[model samples]
Target: MAASPELEGTESPAPRGPRELRLYGLNAVHAAFAKRPEAIRKLYLVQSRIPALQPLLAWCVAHRVGYRVVEEADLEKLSGSAHHEGVVADVLRAEPESLSTWLRDLPAGPQLAIWLDGVGNPHNLGAILRSAAHFGVAAVLLPKHSSLALSGAAARVAEGGAEHVPMVRLGRTDNALAQLRGAGFALAATVVAGGRDVFAADLPTRLVYVMGAEGEGMDRELARACDLQLSIPGTGAVESLNVAAATAVLLAAWRSRRPG
Candidate 1:
């Protein structure tokens, strides 16, 4: 069946999962409050630590966000561990945007997007999202299969990037690539061998840089779909750069070339 553009950027309702909002560590909680305070529904702090949390408490109070000073054990229970560092916040999950919506929303200027073929690691995914936000990429595309969702770990690692960049989960990587190609995007896949150096490639403004999983690299179907496959040159001593590191390097290179 021919793929319809209807499903391009649509997101189904968030799946029902854990009830309480789970956020651990002081830094993570602080990041949410500072970057995306509207996501915070309630702030939980240990009674004895309220003094230490005075600044955060004041912000919550001023924002009219709910807060409760509970026992240490209660905070731990709420966060699912004792590593919360005496603070926990009930925050809404970051919403995922449709790929089509992101593409349409692109301003009348240069546009770039990153597509992950089969990334399963939350940290790597999060790091790439952070890089995309930093480089002003239009959006991030992930294959529905074998792709990690935007979890708390991803959000924490992104340091608020997850909230800024739109993330679209595709039903199939190959199909999504086809759609992107139809929309005038040049597909450039990062491969270990048999590809030009990324720096030498004629990466255009509307390019989709594809990065595959760490162990498997780009699959045959994905590699074949690429208008060009590129590699980040490295010393023979190391096999290749990690996906996240490669993403940063590729994004930086692309951004540097854009007309400023």
Candidate 2:
């Protein structure tokens, strides 16, 4: 193991935040630094990764941010996962903006977003975020009571997409529904069956796709409150597509109609 590189300027790592995350994977760490270099608290990586991370290391040295070249085992221990992919970073969690604040700042135009009702799995969330970013989703809306939050594994799975998409906090269901409607967004509740075919449905320009949980599905009342419901027609080989897969398909369907 190489000796930890000493930072020349700063006295120590930035004060640890209440919810700091240990982000891993080359893409995840690189994206985090690209988006917010100031938020990086510390970095750890294997010796072989140094060459590929010259720019990041240079930034660390310039900003007086501490970094260490450790063994692969050390990287795994630091990240709490074997899939750290040669690098790990401790970064402050980016807090989600409140619904009102997001609404206030949103530009008037065609947009798309997803409302994650009960999809709490970190990997699933990561996949959804990755697709959302690929399709230029406006944001991911989280209900006030949802326990869904970004995690290290999620960031790794997202492969940099997490940095591109914003998460919004919605306080109450009724208020959130009304707010979205007032903003000219038509909510489309995605269901497994008994809904319009996604490929054929007239998707709105400003739309919110309500994604349910994997097993129990979305709340019946919430589905009823939506402007319309949509389903993906599939052969009866399986019950339905996984929530993450379904989300990607929905976003793709929406994107297909809005060719610029």
Candidate 3:
């Protein structure tokens, strides 16, 4: 396996924290309530926003989750975002299940999924997940070393999408890949160059799409582990699309080609 020139910059100065993560904004909070209300630890809202949040509040109260009325400044301080729309909640981490667990849970037939090899930006992670959910991707997998952050900002940027997608950590061991392949998935690596155009290529019924992180592209080893590689045919207007943009386009193509 070849070393990635991109791996050198993977180290970050910022520290990571425990599993509990704070989520802010009305859309994110409401979506969480709809999908996984039990995960909510606490809720904070501006008194002015209370009238609009009655149903949500009622649900929270009935479920025994605590809520407190706070000023806008307090809401801002609580969420670390001015765009929080006067709501924030501390919730359990939404980390997804292991590859084997996902495999065991399959209902039937063909499926589609994605793996993020070295994606760095949280907003991009959130946006990619939103696209994944839109195209019915079963889950989004990331390597243990990936710098992707499942943060409050990410959930906010995802609008209501954070509640729908499953995000998991599947490292570079290739164990997950082997299991997926044995289960009949054809893993396709997406590259900026040196592959057939995705628009014209044959796609498998069970597939996993691989994308490298921004600025540094995919790890060479991880890319080589895939069964095949494909590229999005683009004009020379720009060198490459951001990882999130490419992911959305590729997923759209996958959806468009189905036998619906």
Off by over 4 Å in 1: 1-21, 24-31, 34-36, 45-59, 62-64, 69-87
Order of the predicted models by lDDT, top scorer first: 2, 3, 1
lDDT accuracy of residue 176 in candidate 3: 81
Report per-prediction Cα RMSD to one decimal.
10.0, 4.1, 9.1
Candidate 2 local lDDT, 7-67, one digit each (tens): 2332433325667887999999999999999999899888899998999999999999988
Candidates' TM-scores? 0.78, 0.94, 0.88
For the record, the alpha-carbon RMSD of candidate 3 to the native fold, in angstroms, is 9.1
Lowest summed lDDT across 10 adjacent residues in model 1 is found at 1-10
For TM-score, candidate 2 versus 3, the one ahead is 2
| Candidate 2 global TM-score | 0.94
C-alpha local distance difference test of each model: 0.74, 0.91, 0.80
* Top-down TM-score ranking: 2, 3, 1
Error of 3 at 14 (Å): 13
Q: How much is the lDDT of residue 200 in candidate 2?
A: 97
User: Best-fitting candidate, measured by lDDT?
Assistant: 2
Residue-level lDDT of model 1, residues 1-260, one tens digit each, is: 22124223434312225443456556667776777777777776777777877887888889998777666766555555546678767777665566666656667556788888777887897788788888998888877765367765565677667656777767666667667766788988889877898888778778888888889987887788789988888887988889999999999888888857
Deviating ranges (above 4 Å) for candidate 2: 2-17
What are the runs in model 3 whose C-alpha is more than 4 Å off? 1-17, 147-149
Could you give candidate 3's per-residue lDDT for residues 28-115 as a string of tens digits? 8888888988888878787788887898889887988877876676666666668888888888887767777878887677688888
